[model samples]
Target: MSETNKDDRAALLAEAAGPATELPPGWLEVVSMDMDAQGVARKSDGKVVFIDGALPTEWVSANTHRKKNNWEAASLMAIHRESAQRVRPGCPHFGLHSGACGGCKMQHLHVGAQVAVKQRVLEDNLWHLGKVKAETILRPIEGPAWGYRYRARLSVRYVPKKGEVLVGFHERKSRYIADMQTCKILPPHVDAMLMPLRALIGGLQARDTCPQIELACGDTVTALVLRHLEPLSEGDLARLRAFAAEHGVQWWLQPKGPDTVHLLDADGAEQLAYGLPDFGITMPFKPTDFTQVNSHINRVLVTRALRLLDAGKAERVIDWFCGLGNFTLPIATQAREVLGIEGSEALVARSRENYEKNQAQRPVQQALAATSFVARNLFEMTPEMLVADGVADKWLVDPPREGAFALSKALADLHQARLGAEGAPPLPAGAAHWVPPQRIVYVSCNPATLARDAGLLVHQAGYRCVAAGVVNMFPHTAHVESMAVFERA
Candidate 1:
């Protein structure tokens, strides 16, 4: 009776308990941080482990959550030795703990250390990926550590069981939304609206149908785009209007795709704009349109790029991938005739409009009439097109994540074609003649792509990497924005 019953009971208990949870092997000292801001540690058996919420030079116990052939992804269980660079996180929702917000990483690391790590990341990418090194590293561009995020896409979900609506970023490593009360990275006013926004959504008849709220903050006004899957009733519209009025915010409703977004109260909405007070330029942009998330860093970055380009009043310059004339308009203030080029015709038109608006407000003294925007598919650039653009003393290239590979290659090809095998006939005059800019300033968001482009500019295009450095555009996050300067050898 005892042996048979005991065996049966043990089997039942084991079945109820499900699979046994495997404990982590042991605590390890964090050696360094990876590109994603995860601490890197090697297990005793030689397998590398990535521990989230752990810093370099810190000893931490971690549980392996995911296993791979070369490395394992782990969650920080306990920090036995903390780094001096560690600090109290600004946002309570930040960390690898349960129900933590995934909005920001590196918040626990000191701001200075974050920038230093980013600089190392940039340099490492340049050397390892492209085998190129800058002659000098420019000083890192730093800005406000908090409340610098002017753009954010906040998720919204209605939980019936909880009888509340959640409005914030997604939970760390989970699809579910984080129950955030306030966001430190967002502007103060927008951060304060989180709870109220949740309440407003909770009161809506189509509360569950509303999925997201996008925030775009300008110099004067903040715009919130609410994505509603179902049709909003009159009552819902009224409530939104009231919220807009009370909070002094503009409300945009997206019925389906981003293209369908429209202002709820157009007349009452204030124009969304940002000012580069240094350049005396103001840029008006749509809420959905791509704009720099940090205005402070952008202003500084633009100033630095222009400084590196070193455009003179009598020198002509070209700005590639110019959006809303952020760099082009400012460059126009210095150069003789600045041409702004973009891939999108709509963006080119918007750049022209922004130029006109700024010009009308404060007349551009140098080359006001010569400052123009042209639409071209920069990604499909050719050597012929490069030669046709005419000679410019300086160039400003700010490409997306894809980088300016085609443009870089075009420059290299144009340089080769002009030489003509040492003894070829002279080229025709005018735009057909290959003339490259003496100086070029490149603004980039992806370090790997930037490195690749830089390699071309240095080895193929006959440009020397004069200087490069990191830009802290998105602080408390792993995003690396940088600028580099090049001069024809």
Candidate 2:
């Protein structure tokens, strides 16, 4: 073929294979939103596109940058259609701009509507993935939608080209840090200190050495664990001390993993702590403690779990997967006897210390004196262990992401042996029938595990999923925190 003929054909093929370099101005009708909050719309050539920063029912001009088989990803060039529900985000850092904060995705949607969307996400995932449905829905537990986050791990980065240091969350759709002065999701105290953090990190001698900051807020104290890549200089250590004292924050340094974390303040007095004032209990741990991020939701969840347990002077209770005595101490208050079991020996030890702390302060220690804790492989807990532990009348199951599938199944098997008419394996051959709790309140971070565990409780353990509901524990993200009540059928 002639060179000119080949060139013409290649040019034509490239034009057909790639998206048009220029898009004609036209109003794009919006449809539904994707998981990332992008609005789905069609282009001038009838190709569907996902438009960022566009809400449902809103028309916009989208510039396509990437094309997919069924849809193209675009950035909103202009909004031609607006929805009545769309309102200006109160936070200036919100949007799809180059350096916008990625902490919040539903900032454009109203808080009420956010709850509805989360509910829909939860219910849909349950039906689609688990083929299960709850007969009753508990009222969506809601809390302060703004500045409620008490836990966060903020990223830190330094760029020579930008000639600046950034200390915050990553920017939307990018790896660079968000050039943000404040965060709307942080509690007022921490949110107001964003600029101070920037200035503080800038002042530290280990400014570049520090790569992250972990924030943990208890009822009265705010702790920050500076994740340092290099050992801090004496001068840097002093600076951290001053910053902690000046800002009323606790500071810890991590040169390695969590075990290397240590307090930097004078007298080493600054320790991460959370208090359950209702239980008159206090827990002291490192900033790396896996406490709930939303304090309000956790408080409510604990109260509900205890209420469902119905612990009283005569009733015994077991708090499985107890962390820092969150529910164990509270259950100890009402139960005749409470046994809190945990897998992490460190967590179990902390729980025991917390119970001791509770006992030392309260006169009721001598009066109640019913709670004790044990560290065991709860993930592998069997009917023998359950019976050996002396199963209580009520149980609170709070497992991690893997969920308590084995433990739940064992509980079901124990119930079968205890209530079996006769000759039913005789309690694992010589082992007594494992103690079977009358009711179980299961708290789960993963819905699939919860659904699976709930199925076992209902079908095998003779309990019914009486109530289930979602908790917006980690707001503005897809993580669904839910609780379920299982009553004997």
For lDDT, the strongest prediction is 1
User: What is the per-residue lDDT of model 2 for residues 1-489, given as tens digits with 9 covering 90 to 100?
Assistant: 233433332333334343433434677777555445666565545466667788777767878897554456788898766876687786898888777988787678777666666666556445544455767887877788788899999998766686667878887878878988888889998988888888878887778788999999977778888899987888987877787778898887788988888777647465567776666666676678778889888888887777767777888888889988888888887888888888888888888787786687778444444678888888797877777776478889899988898888787787777778354434765446444677788888877678777777776777877777888886665467888888777
Q: Which candidate is the best by TM-score?
A: 1
Cα displacement (Å) at residue 192, model 1 = 0.7
Instruction: Report the Cα lDDT for candidate 2.
Output: 0.75
Q: For candidate 1, lDDT tens digit of each residue in 241-323?
A: 99988999999999998779999988746789999888888899999988999988998998888888878889999999997
TM-score (all chains, Cα) for each model: 0.90, 0.82
By TM-score, how accurate is candidate 2? 0.82
RMSD of each: 9.8, 8.8
